[model samples]
Target: MDLAGMERSSLVKYLVRQLEHFFPDGQHDLSFRIEKDLDQALARLEVCIDAVKIWRKGEFDYLHSSQYTIFLYFLSNTIWRSRQDKRLCTKLFYLNKALNGIDCFYEIEMPDIFFIGHSVGIVLAKADYANYLVLYQNSTVGKNHGIAPKLEEGVIMYPNTAIIGDCHVKARSVIAQGVSVINKDTMPNSYVFQSNSGALEFKPCSKNILGDIFRHV
Candidate 1:
């Protein structure tokens, strides 16, 4: 994959510089440790980028805020899984949060292939997320009473929508904008809408909406 105008080494240096700028405690430099797992993280990110039809498959621009947000998440998650270094992971997590106004922690096991429409005001918890999950701005998938939602494949959470607590969001379910699905279940291949009386409503989806964003859904 092309790293915009940077080589792999240059990208590593750029990331290290950004981290150092954000966290300047002068304890230990992160160039060596971050570079160790960067290749694997980039490989994972490549798979995700390739699946999204809207993004160029072989190109990654660090200057792009949404792409960089996803990249930081992948890097932090990869390092956390590989080395289990809490300090380094925390810094990366904080960097991601500071740069992109999102609260996706490194411990949250996001899907292998997912798309972020806008990074701002997005908060994802430790939920069971499947592939082709598309999240928009101000969207949330959070836990309540220690129970998180289970989202199946081809699920799209529109802007200002939420799926919280004990909800089984079935496959190909599209949660409408500005709707909150709390402790509720959605039917497969349905559109979740809120009614006048604040009741949850489900309607069949006519087309494969995910096809517009994903290469194969």
Candidate 2:
């Protein structure tokens, strides 16, 4: 059971408890600044949970309890709002690198609404993402040259998939495991998979692409 399914009165305590895993030894205090940070993090968390449909059952433990998910959620939110406070941006920049090993330079454009799976590598140097994009483990969404590609909405990249370099992954497209789509444009509702000979193949997606991931949503 997720922790968000617990009593409403203990929500902050619950979040702080999980946060303790990252910030230990009484460092997870409810100070004004920390509370402000939590408020911003929770706001972004709402958007992510909505995207994944984690809130459909009125529970958010899967999000809040996840170190990778919640950390990336907060990191993205901080980067989005970094322009407001230079000092905070610098602080968050290091926190993200130290905690998650995910390097998102402040200049890179990160979508506020997205879900990240475990061990995800996002270089996204110049890439722009649409809503409802799912990134699985060991996957990379980045660029080859200076130019990065744009991903449309409802794109699900399976584990080890790499979408790179000035490509357009259309809406509702599924990038299969270990498939590398470099400098190519994918059709909407298409599936890009790997052949036995290690070649990339494209076909129409016959099954529900985002259904299993966002099933509850």
Candidate 3:
């Protein structure tokens, strides 16, 4: 993605136009603000790009760029958060729908950093997040019984993993595929999953599942 190219320029222009359409707050300097935060935005984008591995050998793959778009939309929302205008929030809220990321609105309190792979059925509610979080497809982290989960750093949620309720998922934990942790406090450095008997299980997780992505950060 060459920022100087016409394609990138046109895309940015279209996004700005969309923001203007939905939010007429008239922040003419919004583009400049995005550019000012480009380093951090690119850093966040790098996490998702590394997580997805769509580009190999320095070659970009257009077929899988929806992941790219997802992260970019997140970055845009994050930048707007710093600006914090009602109209901007509305723009980002609808932008989530426009990006096809179900229930992944921008008003949620996101981590200092995180990654959403393909962002399928990802519902980020009003919960606090730590850094180095990775969310796979169909994974959800939201409130249950009027309480939201608190996620620590280096927590990875595999596909269909749900951490609902007032659960405390400690650092360096991996919620395995199809597992749900509702109202349970997870142990740090553990792997939590579903057993063959349809019950949840937990064990020590000593692997670096997202090492490359975090190392780049």
Candidate 4:
């Protein structure tokens, strides 16, 4: 049902088709048994966040601590590699479409949210996400280490900004024009901008910042 360079041989595609079959009427019915599995995706996101919160507490027990460390790397790689994975993309595509029918994706049981610019240029390996998060063109969420980052509700990212590591970006946070965040927390009601200094700096998220962000996108 989708076009473009999408590969049918891709696993993401196969699942999407399979999922499409479940929606003969072209609508997602929450009561479908297959829908239960959707919870797994949300669980994965939560677990990733928990891992980061633990490390941030500075509890370095080596063996046990290493578990989350491995998971963190695996997640980062999964998000990136999945972009190359046709199967993953297929699943993501139909998943979004399937869930969209509900008119409230924020309450849905899903993860790995992506935008139209696509899964290819985007990577979100984040651990925590508030409802109503939106990602646009080429944005990435991975890590510099095992830092599990928290992205609050209504956060919108633009093209080519890689938000890496365990940073807490507060609610309604606006990541301004091509900025990257790593290993730090951003305050609520903030606007992030790329300074001439080559790093992302935060200021109160003013109407000016919001207007500029909407304008660029």
lDDT values, one for every candidate: 0.92, 0.63, 0.67, 0.47
Per-candidate TM-scores read 0.98, 0.71, 0.72, 0.46
lDDT by residue (tens digit), candidate 3, 13-50: 66677667767776886566555555565555555454
lDDT of 4: 0.47
Candidate 2 lDDT over 101-212, as tens digits, reads 5555655555656666653454445578787778766777777777788899888888878888979889988998879888888889888887787666789978875776
Name the runs in model 3 displaced over 4 angstroms: 1-11, 17-76, 196-198
lDDT of 4 at 48: 34
lDDT of 1 at 177: 97
State, as a TM-score between 0 and 1, how close model 3 is to the true structure. 0.72
Worst 10 residues of 4 by lDDT: 101-110
Higher-lDDT candidate of 2 and 3 = 3
CA RMSD for every model?
0.9, 4.7, 4.4, 15.6
**Model 1: CA > 4 A from native:** none
Ranking by lDDT: 1, 3, 2, 4
What residue pairs are clashing in model 1? none
Residue-level lDDT of model 4, residues 1-217, one tens digit each, is: 2212333234233444555675455644423322334334324533433333223232222123232222222332344343433333334444443433211112222233212222334555536766445465567777576776778765767666767886888876777657888777777777778778776777876564333322222
